[model samples]
Target: MSGAVQAGYAPPTGPDQPTSGRRWVRWLVAATVLWAVLLAVLTWFSIRDDPPTVREQRSLAEAGPVTDRAVGELLAAAGDGGAARLLPDVLRTGCRITPMEDGAALTRGVEVLLPGDDARGLLQRVADRLPASWRAGVETTGDGPVLRADAGEFVAVEGHATGADRVRFTAATGCRPVGDGYRPLAGGGGPETDQATALLRAWGGPAGQVDHVAAACPGGATARTARAESAPAADRPSLADALAAARGGAVGVRATPEVYAWRAAGTSVVAERVDDRIRVTVTTGCDA
Candidate 1:
């Protein structure tokens, strides 16, 4: 019989022909996936440390010197430190400081009574006192202009003058401004409390007369304002006399240099000289 060819039957040649196109495409896909995964891993590692950015570092650095200067100014104004004694009388009198001690922390704040209604001038004066490097600026808040030193040891010194001759100044030593002191949790006690009671007694303010007011203070401190009246001002002991008596009774007394004011525990007593009479205001939660 004669061999007849099939219509479309083709014999295979050697081994199967390689699928080059599909193989190349698979390899290319694998390589791309591998490269993407490698890139993602590298990116994650690069930022894993979470180091401070340039902006943050600059801010922190700028704040350090500014805060230090503010602290120095506060110390000088307070007149309690050895450095304060060296300062000129004019600079020292620009403000008065009251120091509060909490555990191992020692913090001081200032109270300024400016002469005129130049609230802006007062703010500018304080800003000028800082080193030129601080680049102090005044930002207007609801109350008044708040002097701010960005990235500093002392964050801000804020004050306001509603009118003329009624300026109130306060300084914030910490990174954040103190929001009317720590909120009082509840109750009150400690040797400080006892001292406060004794001081009030020395001032002739009956324990019954101590009225409580809502106050923001550490440990939920309750504010008390004790007023001694219905008697001649002369009959009442001056703030100095009361403080002396209190100190003699073994009460801790921290007095301003002028001797017209003193603080015991968290209580503050100020003797305001008006004409020939002196009015005494005994208040608790003073630094709170």
Candidate 2:
């Protein structure tokens, strides 16, 4: 009777007293789990839109060199022609990136003035000459035959006929961030300058404001092109006759009333009449 409590009396310490502590511990564990899950979700959202790698995040300025090299490769592939005009400005304007959630892209190109009307044949030749790694191939589209390939480093190359006498080749870089501003590299005229000058004098007279663009060739050499325009001389012979005479019976690559293309001393020379003025272009270091 001394140890036994009465019916209405009970001990203060019992199994139920420990339940509050356990409930507090459970609440703490749930709070920690929720916090961890929230942090993980936030981290995933922050990175979901980022580029997969740094290579894809290049800016226009950063990708300029790659684009220029690609241009060179295109020119080299089509170098058999008489003249090539680098379209750096077109690339700059076409690839100008605008701010967006998905970034932007870049592209560069060149125009080769080809003689003869066999545009498809010329494209085939260019495709065959492209680097084996490029996997160059020709596809006939509704417009015409097109040459498409990859220039490595995620750059793409394409060549298509723009006119009966012009074929354009372009290199493109896929989507990227709009990085720093782009400035074209300054290039000096090579020996081609003198060749262009001579052709200009033969075709017209003195040229005004000659422009030049240079590219790297396959053998660590530099390919240079010089362009100029001047008023046709009234006393000079016709472009075809003049170019024919200048060629010295070596056979002209192209001859027409408005345009003439020929090779002189390892350089390609092209003279074409634009309105009343004749434009002369000379290219060197891409003969091979």
RMSD (Cα, Å) for all candidates, in order, is 14.8, 7.9
Error of model 1, residue 128, in angstroms: 2.6
The candidate scoring highest on TM-score is 2
Q: What residue pairs clash in candidate 1, if any at all?
A: 63-151, 63-152, 67-153, 67-154, 117-164, 184-220, 184-221, 185-219, 185-220, 186-220
Task: Score each candidate by Cα lDDT.
Answer: 0.42, 0.71
Which candidate achieves the best lDDT against the true structure? 2
Off by over 4 Å in 2: 1-56, 81-88, 91-107, 174-186, 231-237, 249-251, 264-266
lDDT of 2 at 273: 81
Per-residue lDDT tens digits for candidate 1, residues 112-131, read: 33323466776666566555
Write model 2 residue lDDT over 1-288, tens digit each, in one string: 588878988768676576677889999999999999999998787668754344465565676666667677777777666456665444423433345344556677777777577778878888898789989999999999999998765677888989987888888877665567545555565666776777777765787777887666666566677888886555666798666666675436667878887764446677888877888877674553
TM-score of each: 0.33, 0.71
